[model samples]
Every structure is written in C-alpha cells, then in structure tokens.
Target chain A: MGVDERRQQLIGVALELFSRRSPDEVSIDEIASAAGISRPLVYHYFPGKISLYEAALQRASDDLASRFVEPPEGPLGARLLRVMRRFFDFVDDHGPGFAALMRGGPAVGSSTTNALVDGVRQAAYLQMLSHLKIEDPPARLELVIRSWISLVESTALIWLDGRRIPRAELEVQLVHDFAALAAVSAAYDQEMAEVLRQGLKDEPGEGPFSDLVVRLVALASPPAV
Target chain B: MGVDERRQQLIGVALELFSRRSPDEVSIDEIASAAGISRPLVYHYFPGKISLYEAALQRASDDLASRFVEPPEGPLGARLLRVMRRFFDFVDDHGPGFAALMRGGPAVGSSTTNALVDGVRQAAYLQMLSHLKIEDPPARLELVIRSWISLVESTALIWLDGRRIPRAELEVQLVHDFAALAAVSAAYDQEMAEVLRQGLKDEPGEGPFSDLVVRLVALASPPAV
Candidate 1:
C-alpha cells in the first residue's frame, strides 16, 4: 500500500478498537497485529498510539466541519435548519466515530486534538452568528452563541442514543427549538445593548460578577456591535 | 472494615480509577492497591472487574435519581424549573461522576453504560410526566415528554462543559428554555390530542414523519393516556 493508504488503514483499525474499547485499553502491539503490519511500520506512519488517535479524530472533525460550515444564503432560520439537518445526518451515518469524539476519545483529551475540535466548533458558531441580524449588546450575543452550541451538541447526543423517535422528526423539533431560543436570546441581547448604550455605568449597584458578564459578552460579538 | 464498608470503599476506589482510565486499563490489583486492600478482598466484595464497575455505576445512577426524582408541587413548568436547577447543581458539584455517567466512563463501553444511564433517565421522565396535566392523546403526550427531556439534557451538558457563563446563569437560562419548550410541546400536544379525540377520520393531513413525531410526543405521558 502507498503511504497514505497505509496511514488511512491504521486510523480505521484504531477507530474500530476505540469503539469496541476505551483508547487506553487498546495496545499499540494489538493495533499493529490487527492491521497485519509490523509494529515499527505502525510507528513509521504515526509516532505513537496517541498520534494515531489524533489523526482519526481530526479526520472526523474535519469531515463534520466541511459538511456544515457553509454560510446560509437565505433567511438565518432557514440556514440554521439546514445546518441542523446536516449535523443529524452526519451523526447517524458516522455513529461510532462521532461517539468517540463526543465521548472524549483519546484525541479529544490531548490539547492538540481539543484545539482542532474547538476550532471547528468556533468556526461553526461564527457561521451561525453571520446569519443573525440582531441589534444586541455583546454580552447577550455571547449567551446566544453559547446557547446555540449547547442546543446542537445536546440534541445530537440524545439522538445518538437510539431513542425510538425517527431522525427526521427529531430534527424538525430541534430546528424549531433552536429558532425559539434564538428569538429569546436576540431580544435579551437588544435589551442589554440598550443598557450599555445608555451609559449605565457599572456602579456599586451591580456586583463584581456583573462586570465579568459584561466583559464576556463583549468578547463574543463582532466589533461593530 | 466490615464487608459492606469494604465493598463501598472498593467501589469508590474503582470509580476513581474508572474516572481517570477506562475499566480495562485499571486492573483489580490496581483498585485493590489504591484502596489499601488485597486483590482477593476486592474480588470478595465483587466477583470481578465488571461487577465492581456496575456496582459503582449503579451507585452514581442512584445518587442522581435520589436528587432529582422527587418533584416539587406546582405548575408543571415551575416543577420542571426546580428540577432543572437541582440537576445542574448536582452535576456542577459532582462533576467527575456525573460527567462519566453522561459521557460514558472508561469502566464500560458506551453502549452498556448508556443503557444504565437511560434507565435512570426514563425514570426521571416518568417523574416529570407526573407533574404534567396532559390534554393530548397518549402519543402526543409521549412526544412532549421526549422533547422536554432532550431540552433539559442538552442545556445541562452545555453548563457541564464549563463555558464562559457561570453555572447559575446557565441554570437560569435553562429553566427559561425548558419553560418555552414545555409550553410549545404542551400546545402541540393539545392540538394532537384534539385531533385524536375527534377520531382518526378527521385527522389533519399527515406531514413528513408526522407519525414518528406523534409517537415520540406520546412516549412522555402515562401509558393509559
């Protein structure tokens, strides 16, 4: 096999082992044996077990990101619905790999692996934000972004558990829920923005956490807002 | 330690190990060593590693059930808000154990541990149903229940990840989201209930995956409904 082919094969075998057992449970020797390759060959393609796991995880994360990161052309809500549908479809098709990433596969534990996933997640969040036309304070916008991310991740996990519900129907409900949450958060963001614009100085009235909340919110949105 | 005390200690130590590494990585010897007991004594409390792991898992499941199962008397939305608050608080306080249960710890595979978690989750679902005054058909009620569960679980996981927001703020937003979802589902349930009550003859034209939607909705209510 070519170098890339051999590398792909190793990741496939590693993922199979990871799905069947925890990352720590499977040994490099066993992975090598199962792949029908010498241990040193396995080492040549990847530095070690952790490296192999990171490769697999990055592949899955990238696949998901590539599939869902397009900017929606029409209404923001419609675009979001499309994104939700794509995500649900990905989880259904790639159950084991998605499960491993979500369940914190060895790759997710490493700072490098986490950075990749976090990068994708942030990119997706920015895409969602790009579709919004809300005039809200920065703090409220951050909450909206965080809430939307949570909703998608949480919904996907439940669907993966194989509840008796059909995938299509669940997706519809999720899309609706996402719309409702966005509406509420948008309203709250506007309220906060107005408060800040009015020069409601952080006085002794609000408490220390109030400033923290304002700062976090400011960090979440575009500079123009 | 007495047999029961020793068993509890073993389970505790096993859970700690399971938290750090998958079940297969931690041997009975390691658990015994950590607990300052003999391997034979550890085996004496439980037959093998799997049994010990299950025992620890069951204990964690029981702890969550005990904390959230007993409903406070009030409107369905209010009761649900209270439950959501307590649930988030429990998870925040017992981060490792709860995270393991939700995300599937190393002691067992995702499938097995998820089934255990599902059992506790179903019980909680039933408890939530006890609070609702469903005016919908049995099937529609089930969908509402499933949707509500989805909303709460998704919101909680977001908080669990320790994002920028404080837990208290997340908890408050969750309660609001829960109420909004419950209100929407409750309305949908009533609409479906009315349709069913008028007999299947006058049923509205079915949409894509409507039957599955109806089934999921009904799964949340009492079987008799």
Candidate 2:
C-alpha cells in the first residue's frame, strides 16, 4: 500500500481497537497484530503510541462531527431529528471511545486531542447556526443553541453509562429538547420568538415541534382519570 | 490562633485567593501573605501547596453542594429558581475557581478533585429529587432531571466566558429550561407526566413553569405581525 493508504489503514485499525477498549489499555503490539503488520512497521508509520492514538482520535472526531451534518431541506424538526439519529449512531458505534474522549481519559491529554474534541463541538455549533440560517444569532438564541449542544453531549455521555434508555427514544427526545429549549427562549425574547417562528413555519403536524405542542397542550388540561 | 482555627483560616485565605485567580497561579507565599502568616508557618499547618489547595477545594465543594439545599415548601418552579440563583451565586462569586474546576485546569487533576466536583453534582441531583418528593424517580424522569442538571452546569460555564446575557434572566431561564425538559418528557411518559403534575401543584401563574406554559401557548398561535 502507498504511505497515505497505509496511514489510513492504521488509523482505522487503531480506532476500532480504541472503540472497544481505551487507547491507554491497547498496546502497540496489539495494534500491529490487528493490522497484520510487524511492531517495527507500526513504528515506521507512526513515531509512538501517543501519536498513533492521536491520529485515531482525529479520525473519530472528524467522523463524529460529520454526523451533525444535515441538508437544510425539510422541516427544522425533521432536520434536527435526522441529525440526532446520525449523532447517536456515532455514539452507539463508538461507545467506549466516545465516553473516554468526552471524559478526558488518561491516554488523551494532549492539546491536539483537546482541540479535536473542541473541533467537533464547534462544527456542531456552526452546523446548527447554518440550519437556523442566521449568520449572526442574537445572544439568547446563541445561548439556547450552545446549551442544546451541551445537552446533546451530556445526554450521550449519561446514556452510555448503562445504556438504560432506548437509543431511538432518546434521539426523538433530544430533537424535542432542542424545540423545548427554543420554545422557552422564544417565550422570553422577541428575537428568539422570530427564530422559532421561522423554524416552525415549514414544520408539519407530525413534526417534532407539533408533537411538542400537542404534548404541552395535554399538560395544560386537568390530568385524565 | 489554635491549630484548628489556624487551619480553617488558612483554607479560607487559600480559597479566597483561588477564587480570584486560578489555583495554579497562586503560590504558597501569597497564601501565607494573604493569611498574615509566614511562608514557613504555612507549611507548618499543611504539608505543601497541593494539600492546602485540596483542603481549600474541599471547603468550596461543601459550600457549593450546600447551595443546592432548599426547603420543599414553595412552588417547585420558585424553589428551583432559588436553587439556580444560589448555584449561579457560587459561579459568580468564585468565577475563576468555578471556571477552573469545571474546565479541569492544570491545577486540578487528582481523583480527589474529581470526586469533589462529582460530589457537587450528586448533591444537586438529590436536592432536586427531594424537592420532587420522589424516593426513586422513574427512568425517564431521572433522565429529564439529570439532563436539566447538566444544562445548568453548562449554562454557568458558558455564562462565565462572557457575561453577555443578564444573570437574572439566565437564572430564571434555567428554571424555565427545567420545566421545558420535564414538559417534553411528560408528553412522552406517563410517569414523568405525573411527576410534573405534582411539581406544578402549588405553582402560581407567575411561577417559572406557568410562565413557560403561557409562552408555549402563545407560540401555538400566529405570531403578532
């Protein structure tokens, strides 16, 4: 294989091992063995374990960030739900690695690793703003978006603890969470209200926002016997 | 001063200093100077700077955990708003320390420090459960509450970066965020619905939950053109 192809192959192999166990626990020998390459060959491709681990992390981070991408073609709720689906797909696929990276496990102390994680969050934030089609969001709107992004991150972290909640439900619930956050902000600031208005303009009766309205209106009435 | 009084005084001085500047920047000499004691005398009380830092951190952590304490007498929204106020008060007062602790700065790495931070989050969780009058929350209810707690944490961290939004508004908005979270969960799960019902039982129209409802209902109508 060419140098570039060998590097990509090694990164893929390292990410797979790191996903199952922490990078710290996985040895260079094991990575080479998995790649069917000699340990010396592994060293030739990368300087050491930390460098290889970082390369793997960079790959995973890019993949994770890309999961937030969605074409701004449908209702905002539908678009967000699709994003959540892909987001959770990454979490579900890369459980231990995702948890370790977010929790800052021992093997991941470099500023480069930190930047990779931050890059994912930044990409997610910009993707969200793109969905909102706002080059410059109002402060409250920005807070709402940033808070929702953090919520998604934490939700994924907590959900990984025991896999207690069903993944599908959490995906839909998170999209609803974004709506709920936006709704609360809209209620307070007129700018947020206008943003929510534009977001919901194309939403269908079966969209997440409508589902939230239906659910909330049910809450307004007396509880059923 | 007696030995115990001296230690307490030292911890107090260290925390005050740490609160203003990152603990990594504050030296033992400064801590001694601030406490009106000699550098050698500072070591006489504690082994070294790290131990003194931990002692100070323990005090701050205990105080932070205590801020979550609230009587269960008032409306849930009002009670939660009060809790948010105190939470933000800690964040506001200990700006540098709070940011450092949350962001995991160079000064903090030991498992003990991690435990202290976790202690604060765990204390806040129990306080919330106590206010809900729940001995054991159902799964969905627990998810909503935990997610809300994370929201509060991130909000404080983000708010600290730049105090662009008004502090009072963010505090109240957080209470609304909790209501919004539980509202979304209630719409999905009967258990959460019942939980939210009990929470809103004594809430007045001006309560955060009611305010959220009023705002959400307004969104159901056409925007004011």
Candidate 3:
C-alpha cells in the first residue's frame, strides 16, 4: 500500500481495536500485527501511540460531525429528522468509541481531544442554525439549541450503553424536542417565535412527523395567527 | 482526631487533592503531607491510595447528590428552581471533582463509582417525580424527565469548562426546560397533559418564574379547560 493508504489502513485497525479495548490496553505490536505491518511502519505513520490515538479520535469526530449536515431540500422538521437519523446511525455504528468520545474522561482529557469533540457539537449547532436560516440566535435561543443538542448527546450516550428506547422512537423524540424548544423560546424570545413560525409552516405532511404534528402545532399556542 | 474522625478528615484532604489533579498523578505521600500526617497514618485509615481515592469519590458523589433535594412547597416551577439552584451550587463548589465523577474515565470507572453516580441521578429523578405528585409517571413522562435531567447535567458539565451563561440564568433556563418538556409531553400523553394542567395552575405568580410562566401558561394551548 502507498504511504497514505497504509496510514489510513493503520487508523482503521486502531479504531477497530480501540473500540473494543481502551488505548492503554492496546499495544503497538498488536496494532502492527493486526495490519500485517512492521512496528516501524506503524511508528513511521504515527510518531507514537498517543499520536495514532489522536488521529483515530479526530477521524471519528470528523465522520460523526459530517453526518449532522443535511441538504436544505425538505421541510425543516424533515430536514432535522434526517440530521438526527444520521446522528443515531453514527452512535449505532460506533457505540463504544462514540461513547468514550462524548463521555470524555481522564483518559481523553487532552485539549486536542476536547476540541475534536467540541468540533462535532459546534458543527451540529451550526447545522441546526442553518436549518432555521439563523445567523446569530439570541442567547436564550442559542442556549435552547445548545441545550437540546446536549440532551441528544447525553441521551445518545446513555442509549448506547444500554438500549432502553428503540432508534425510531429516539429520532421522533429528538425532532419533537427541537420543535418544543422552538415553541418554548417563542413564548420568551420574539425572534425565536418568528423563527418557529417560519420553520414549522413548511413542515412536510408526508414523513414520520404526521402523528406528532398535531401536538406540535398545538404547542405553538395563540395559533401564531 | 479519633480513628473515625481521622478517616473522614483524611478523605476530605484526598478529595481536595484529587480535585486538583487526576487520581494517577496524586500520590500517597502528597496526601499524607497535605494532611500533616505520616504516610503510615494515612494508610492506617485507608488501606491504600486507591481505597482513599474511592472513599473520597463516594463522599463527593454523596454530597453532590444530596444537594439536589429541596422541600416540596408552593409551586412546581418554584420547587424546581429551588432544586436547580442547589444543583448549580454543587457544580460550582465541586467543579473539578464533580467533573471527574461525572466524566467517569479510566481513573474512576469502577462499577461501584458508576453505581454511585447513577444513584445521584436516580435521586434527582425521584425528587422531580415527587414534586409532580405522581408516584408512577408513564414511560413517556419518565423518559421526558430523565432527558431533561441529562440536559441539566450535560450543560452544567460544559459550563464548568467555560462560563458562557451566568449561573443564575442557567438555573432559570434549566427550570424552563423541565416546564417545556412537561408541556411537550402533555400534548401527546394524557397523563402528562393533566400533570401539566395541575402544575401550571399552581405555579405561583412570584419568584424567577413570573416572566417564564406567561410563556408556559400559554403553552398549554386550547386552555386544557
């Protein structure tokens, strides 16, 4: 394999192994053996295990963050559900690594790792704002969106640990959460109220939201008339 | 100090030290010196460094969890603000230790520590259910409350890392989130709808909730009358 291809292959091996075992528990020889490469080759690609682990984490975070972006082609609710579906899928595909990344601990407390994880969240935040066609949300609205993302992150972290609620319900519940937050903000922040008004008006009647739409429309009390 | 007093005192010293540095970086001699005692004296109270660390962690988790409780009084929103204030205070006071405990990295990944952390979350969960006056909330309501608590926990975790929102506003925002979740759940679940009805009806026209109540009361659209 070429140098770049070899690097990518090694990272994939590390990610697969790291998912099942903590980094400290995994050895350089083990990684090399997994790849049928010499230990020197692993070191040539990554100066040390820490560097390799960082690469793996960055790759994981990048992949997860990119999944949050959705084409602005559908209704806002439908658009958000698409983003959420991708998010849940990432959590499903990488249950262990994603859990450790989201649940940062002494093992992953470096500044770089924190930034990588925060990048994913920041990307998710920007995607939601983009969906709302918002440039700068008021602090309450910003907090509302950030808190909702946190809710999704925390809930996803716990769900990966043990499957309590199934994925389909989890998706709708998250979509409903964004709508509820928008309505709640509308009650407090006028700007958000208008944002909610514009966003929900275009909610498509053809998706999984058909059932939840009635209650959601009711949440926007005073009819926004 | 007597033996029991010495044990508690030593644990307190260790907790302070662990808060400053990760467990692996902390040493027995440092804890002993901080306590102005010999290493043997430290070992006398706790078998080893890990035992002392575990004890310190337990003490911190127990203290943090106890802070979540508040007297069941006047209004649901009012009672919740009281609980939230206590929750934020724990985060403020025990920022680092609280961070470590909640993060649950390799340093403190013992099953017992996990149980201790979960216990706190459960206590907070039960307290909110109590304020709702519902002994057995429906599954949806349970998930709703649990998700909100998770939001509070995740938000507080990030806030400690950096103080973007003031503690006071964060507390009110969290209180507002619970109300919003209650309102959202009500629209679909009949039990939650009634719970929202009774809770809002009793929300006092006083305290921090005064402004938010105007928005929340409007959330129970169609007047639930």
Compose the digit string of candidate 1's lDDT tens values, residues A149-216. Answer: 75566566666665545666556556556544543443334554333223223223343223323432
**Candidate 3 lDDT over residue span B33-66, tens digit each:** 9999999988888898878988988888788777
| Model 1, position A214: C-alpha lDDT score | 44
Number of the top candidate by TM-score? 2
Q: Give me the runs in candidate 1 sitting further than 4 Å from their true place.
A: A5-57, A72-74, A89-123, A130-147, A153-172, A184-225, B9-54, B71-73, B100-112, B133-154, B160-169, B183-225
Clashing pairs in 3: none
Candidate 1 docking classification: incorrect
Q: What would the per-residue lDDT of candidate 2 be over residues A52-136, giving only the tens digit for each residue?
A: 9999988888888888888888788888888999999888888888787776645765567777877988899999999988899
Arrange candidates by lDDT, descending: 2, 3, 1
Question: Which digits, one per residue and each the tens of the lDDT, describe model 1 over residues B1-225?
Answer: 788888888888887776565455678999999999888888778999888888878877777676556544433434544676777766665555555455443445445566677777777767755555343325434655555565566556555565545666655455455544443333334454343233222223452123323433342222462
Between candidates 2 and 3, the lDDT winner: 2
What overall lDDT, based on C-alpha atoms, would model 1 receive against the true structure? Answer: 0.59
Q: Which stretches of candidate 2 lie over 4 Å from their true place?
A: A1-3, B38-41, B44-48
The DockQ ranking, best first, is 2, 3, 1
